[model samples]
Target chain A: AQSVTQLDSQVPVFEEAPVELRCNYSSSVSVYLFWYVQYPNQGLQLLLKYLSGSTLVKGINGFEAEFNKSQTSFHLRKPSVHISDTAEYFCAVTPRGTQGGSEKLVFGKGTKLTVNP
Target chain B: NAGVTQTPKFRVLKTGQSMTLLCAQDMNHEYMYWYRQDPGMGLRLIHYSVGEGTTAKGEVPDGYNVSRLKKQNFLLGLESAAPSQTSVYFCASSYTGMGPETQYFGPGTRLLVL
Candidate 1:
């Protein structure tokens, strides 16, 4: 089984300030990582994903995440945040190499990001 | 495309009552999932279907049942509702069961059990 841990439960940042949300995972086999954002009363939206290749992957809304295999981390970062960026973010992971069966994603508790003015 | 959609945007049920949530997708996805969201919990998988007529239990499947009679529709039923079952429900669909496939989600249904 795979599991994800988000170090922070809530993060608050001023508008135009940089922010980072930490995430770590545990899996016996190789895995794929993803970041999803959800606004109030809305469903989740894919922010970015890390399947393979470059350690650093970029996503929409000027957000990026770095996959650190050794550290078992996939932290999401943004150089600058806006009020519109305030939302709950989730980190998820699913193991790779699972053939002929459905692979489910294990998600972290979530980190609520509040971009204040 | 409409992507994924869920019926009954909001519902209220009493303990011991029964209700079903419907999910529909137009993306021709082969994999569909049901999940519940709580205050602190990001989301927990309740049940899933890899294809039509194939439903499987997920991380949290107890107290819930699912059916996938059609490729584009998935149904989640709560035989007996409980106070603990009150939460936001989300449905997602992906093109395949591959690890890298992106899952598209529906607007979500808020259920309140009193």
Candidate 2:
């Protein structure tokens, strides 16, 4: 079974400081990866995704993630973060294949990103 | 557009009671999903609908039932609610269930089974 692991449960950073949230996955087959953000009391919003090609994937709000196949990791990062960027982040993976089967995304436990001013 | 909306932003149910949570989307998506968000467990899929009249079980579907009678609506029912069933429910939809497709989410419904 495909699984995702978010290394950090909480990460606190000073305002305008760079940050990195580590994510790793275990899958036997080819997989697609994604990062999602959830604000306080709100639903999730897609940050970025890695389907194929381009190891570096850029997402909304100046965030980017590098998909390293060898490491089985897709880590999210931002050059600088604002107070509004403080939210819970999730890493999800979906194994390649949709022929008469569920193509559901398997999510990690989540990392709470806190941008302190 | 309203995008995706879930009815009854919050609900409290007693054990053994039955209630249904409704999820509606306006994007004309062919794929809809129901997931329960629990602390430390992340989001686990309970059920999904590929199209109208077709529903499938997901990773965690034992305590829930679903119906997709209409293209825009997906209902999740708990025949006999349990305290363990309490969690934040999210509804998501995508154009298709293929690789890398984005799933638009609803605000979510907080259900408490007391």
Candidate 3:
């Protein structure tokens, strides 16, 4: 089984300030990592994903994440945040190989990001 | 495309009552999933279907049942509602069950059990 841990439960930042949300995972096998954002009363949307290749993967809204294998971390970072960036963010992981023709993603408890004006 | 959609944006049920939540996707996805979101718990998978007529239990599936009669539709049913079952339910679909395919999600349904 795979599990994800989001180090922070909540993060607050002033507008135009840089921010980073930490995430770590534990799995017996190789895994894929992802970051998702959800606005109030809305469903989650993919912010970025790390399947393979470059350790630094960029996504929409000027957000990027670095996949650190030795550290077992996939931390999301944004150089500058806006008020609109305030939302709950989730980190998820799924095992690399397909087992029993089924795939499931295990998510972290979530980190609520508040970009204050 | 509508992507993924779930019916009954909000619902209320009493303890011991029964109800079903419907999920529909027009993206021609082969894998569908049901999940529940609780405060401070993020989201937990309830059930999932890799293809039509094939439903599988997920991390938290004890109080729920699922059906996938059609490729584009998945239904989650609660035979007997409990106060612990009150939470936001989300449905998601992906093109395939292999690799790192992206999953598209619906708006979600908020269920309240009293």
Candidate 4:
């Protein structure tokens, strides 16, 4: 089984300010990481994913995340944030496997990002 | 492409009432999932279907049931609604479980159980 932990329950930042949301995961085997964003009353949309390759992965809305293997972390960051960026962010993970025909994700407790004007 | 869509964007049900949420995907995905989202608690999988006619319980599936009669459709049923079940429900689908497959989500359905 895999688990995701988002250290921050909420993060507030001024407009155009940089922000980072911390996420860590625990899994005995290899895993894939992802970041999803959900606006109020909407479903979650993919921000980015770390399947393999470069540690730093860029995403839409000028957001990026770094996958740190040793630390078991996949932290999301945005150099500059806007009011539109205020939403609930979730981190998820799926184990690397072939036994199961499909994979189910384990999500974190979520981090609410509030971009103040 | 319609991607993923869920019916009844918003619904209200009294305790002990029964209802079903429908999900459909046009992406020809082989895997579909139903999840509930609560404050501070990210989405938790309630049930998932790997393929048509096959459903599996997920992390939280106590009072809920699911069916996948067709490959592109999945339905989540609440036999008896409870106040605790008043949350946003989302549907997601993925092409495969193999690796690097991203799950596409629906607009979500908000159910208020009183």
Best of the two (3, 4) by lDDT = 3
Model 3 chain A poorest 10 in a row by lDDT: A96-105
Taking the tens digit of each residue's C-alpha lDDT, what string does model 1 give over A6-75? 9999999999999999999998889989999999888999999999899999999999999999999999
| DockQ of each two-chain model | 0.64, 0.60, 0.63, 0.63
RMSD of 4: 1.4
lDDT of 2 by residue, B43-87 (tens): 999999999999999999998999999999999999999999999
lDDT of 3 at A90: 98
The lDDT, on a scale of 0 to 1, for candidate 2 is 0.93
Off by over 4 Å in 4: A99-102
Least accurate stretch of 10 residues (summed lDDT) in model 4 chain A? A95-104
Candidate 2 CAPRI-style tier: medium
lDDT of 3 by residue, A18-48 (tens): 9999999998889999999998888999999
TM-score for chain A in each prediction: 0.96, 0.95, 0.96, 0.96
- Per-residue lDDT over B1-114 for candidate 3, one digit per residue giving the tens place of the 0 to 100 score: 888999999999999999999999999999999999999998998999999999999989999999999999999999999999999999999998875888889999999999
Judged by DockQ, which candidate is best? Answer: 1
- Poorly placed runs, candidate 1 (over 4 Å): A99-102
By the TM-score metric, which is better: model 1 or model 4? Answer: 1
